[model samples]
Target chain A: MRAFAHTPFGALSIAILRGFVRDRAALFFAVVFPLMFLVLFGALLSNQDQSEIDMITVGDVPLLEDLPADAREAFETTFEVEESDDLDAALAEVRDGDADVVVEQKGDTLVAHYTQTEQVKAAITQSTLKAYVDGANIAASGQPARFGFAAERVEDESLTTIQFFTPGLLGWAIATSAALGAAATLQGWRQTKLLRRLQLAPVSTGTVVGARVAVTIAIALGQTAIFLGLGAATLGLKLTGSWWMSIPLVVVGTLCFMAIGLLAGAIAKSTEGAVNMANFFVLPMAFLSGSFFPLDATPPWLQRVSDVLPLKHLNEGMLDVLVRGQGPSAALVPLTILAAFAVVVTLLAARLFRWDTA
Target chain B: MTAIAAKGLTKRYGDLTAVDALDLTVAAGEFVGVLGPNGAGKTTLLEMLEGLRKPDAGEVSVLGEPAWPRNRALQPRIGVQLQASAFFERLTAREQIHTFAALYRAPGSAADEWLERVGLVAKADTRVEDLSGGQAQRLSIACALVHDPELVFLDEPTAALDPQARRNLWDLLADINDSGRTVVLTTHHMDEAETLCDRVAIVDHGRLLQHDTPAALVAAHAGGGNLEDVFLALTGREYRA
Candidate 1:
């Protein structure tokens, strides 16, 4: 027990944490930078309502359309299209804001107009028009009749930007704090030959690495808590999952990122080079893992790229608990991936680390 | 009993040989100094003996156990002051020493006492980064000696100190030696090697050029002048980086 207490890992961890607190620059980069990013990303994601538009069907247009029997039956059940022949009048109604959108037909052309110049509205109108044109084409070709497009009003839950960004911010905070705290500190220790000294002591390397991982996890959790508290109090964001679920995810994510940091520190020959390596890995994870914005708009191949990032799974797990109010079981895939990442990186770091100045 | 024994020890880094094949032994309770010029492999030999580095081809035994990776039981029995051992910048000198002291199974609780012993009591609470070069060196010594090991390895311990501080450190080291602990140190200062070491090994270009008492070496090679003249005769006046 006495020997265990003096293990290099725990002592180094405590020492590193104390050093971080005393260093104003490190404290700013480790603690404050992520908070600032959270604020920025939160502000940007605040307007969810603007991304969805209301679909207001005008009137019965079935009587005007030369619909096939099967098409007419499907259209009658799905839509309440207006019968107004005055397409200009209906478009004017949309232009006047009385309706969010208006759809009409004019000599083999389907024209859809929106009241507001919203990207969501434009997308919905274009898709609906395409469906109508395709239906008309099928009917003219005397093929089996298909239903015309029917716009359904998607009543999306209006979430503030901060609420939408909270999960991503949490992931970013965990990654930044864990990676910078462990990797950068290790590099500095190596540069000064402190690690070589410690290696000569009665301490094991496992103990040293374990202690650093523990401290990094603690710091990461503190970062997560700060973001959660400020997001809730200041931005009205809420974490819907239980503490038992969220806390474990935080721990797993911290371990995964800390391992990556250790590997980076071990492989980098100098402090300057370590800094460059950390930025090289962490920046890509941040941007591509949907920390700042939704990756849903990106292509399928890009989404596949995000799947390999630990931050992506971290964010997904956080969203599951915070947004979907799911349990730990609901996050098994992400949790497993994070654990796997931690194990692999830890092994790599341990294998690559050099105690002496090479 | 022999506290340290090395046979045909050699270490090489690529094309450069850091520690050439060498045979050395230190009896228990003896104070030995390894004297050499820059790049003479004095530090490298010390590292291998201290179990911080493995010899490419050699057998090293410290307290009857192999020296590379060091037997855990033998660790508490040996203390090492590396050529550039560093402390956490934010930790007070006392904290740093106490932390190291705790590593031993039966360490003293009087960290401040060790600091005072090293002439750092006034700066016990000062962070390591705030200490002067001499003060930091003293603190490093205090850390090494805190556990009161049976054998101590000091490498370049007085390299960057003022004359007064260096003298004080020498007296402290002598006191430690008088207490019946073996001291293995490396230094380039001929006067220090002459005054403090019971036996001296002069090495150059990774090989042992001479091994005997400072008096005996001078009598043999310096025409009875001094260890410096003996050293110059063996290593020559050429500068090495």
Candidate 2:
């Protein structure tokens, strides 16, 4: 009798796994699709030049005048510098896409403001200005060549653009795959009356739901392995710090997204609507969460919004373990948030689930 | 012993009464049919009895066990083939039944036997979506019976089958009944109930008009005509269904 009870759950998981393996759409989203993203973003962001300057100077900016004659001539030739009297208007110009960079001098300190409109150009200006500042500092110090400090990266610091985005892209892919996979599968079962069929067996709704969640998490783990493997082999991704801790985070993150997907399935009346609804919530969350791109330079309000999203925590948690060289302690808060989100959303989904279609 | 006993079974969908104060009972090993047209609440009533839907006010017991609140104890004892159930996607017929058999912890050999019993051995390797409608229905029935439950419920099992396929299914159902496993089936086809059921329950407008053996029902209600004419006389309308 005990055997009778256990087999069904195992069978359900196996059956769901088989169905998922055969589902080309899910395979494309979870594996092939994310691989394409890893390649596309890796190539595009790595080759970008972070040196050309695009700046808007407001009021008296002494940094430009302090540059040596030869360096000032090279700086003036490489960048387009615009002068503005209204600091507020100059900042707005950067915000509104009318301009690329704004260098606001606050007494002795220099503040650079830029927009994501031309993210590549703005990034170049910020780094290039830092280089110019370092040069000026060295010249003023009057130090001999022997006394000058040489720079070296700390042992655990990230080495390249690919390393940072390896986790970022992995986060996005798993989020898409887990959320869309659960929603589509649930809605499809409802539409086809397979849910009703399962109800006839000697299994509780909790058992079926538990099995489904397990299978999704398993697939997500496989996805993480592939992303990490391919990222390291081809994209120069380095795994450091508490990187293995990402395994547990992957499981928890998958639960959170799968819960969201279940909510979409329960709310939408049709399969297509559920898929669209999952996408509607997940796509925006991906960008705000910094899955495809870093949100560090984004405005304060945008970062606050990112804080409210579960995907942000998933990405950020994995980033902490994988690249930031943080310990298991770093994952504690994000894991808690994700687990809590999973519980709340799953309850809501159960409340909204309709048996009529099933 | 009674296989099922349901009393005052009432289910309401807002303003509509899907099943209203219905009473029904099935003796062990008896083949009973619930005959009604589309929108006549046959499927709704069947679902309530199968424990898939909650009743507004009623009591239902399958194999002397409460069917509501989804009694897990009774689940293995009963098999249900829903009106529109689907197979696991992309699975071959053999794999589908094997999966269902595993759910019940039945041996894989039993799954194969059921495939042959349903005459799907030749098409066992075909993917479910590639099977014809009749083959799909037969595979569904085989999957339902793979565990050899004591009782079975089939809803509209032959609704859209061609004449030949329908005839073939009738034989399969007859075999199931001959093996002493009680069967409860709902259908709109008058002849289906009259020919295959030991007792037929005529229903309309969420009410049970009659329940008796076909010969007895005809003699007692219409005194002469076939089941359709008997339906026409009972409800004062042509039995289009």
Candidate with best DockQ:
2
Where does candidate 2 stray beyond 4 Å? A1-6, A48-159, B236-241
TM-score of 1: 0.80
Worst 10 residues of 1 chain B by lDDT: B103-112
Model 1 sits at a Cα RMSD from the real structure of 8.6
The local distance difference test score of each candidate is 0.79, 0.85
Show where candidate 1 strays beyond 4 Å: A1-10, A43-159, B105-108
What DockQ results do all the predictions give, each relative to the true complex? 0.36, 0.48
- State which candidate has the highest TM-score: 2
lDDT value, candidate 1, whole model: 0.79
What are the per-model numbers of colliding residue pairs? 8, 0
Write one digit per residue (lDDT tens) for candidate 1, span A105-223.
45455556674455666666566557666766776799886554455554224334675578887788778768766777788888877787778778786776777777777887787
TM-score of chain B of 1: 0.96
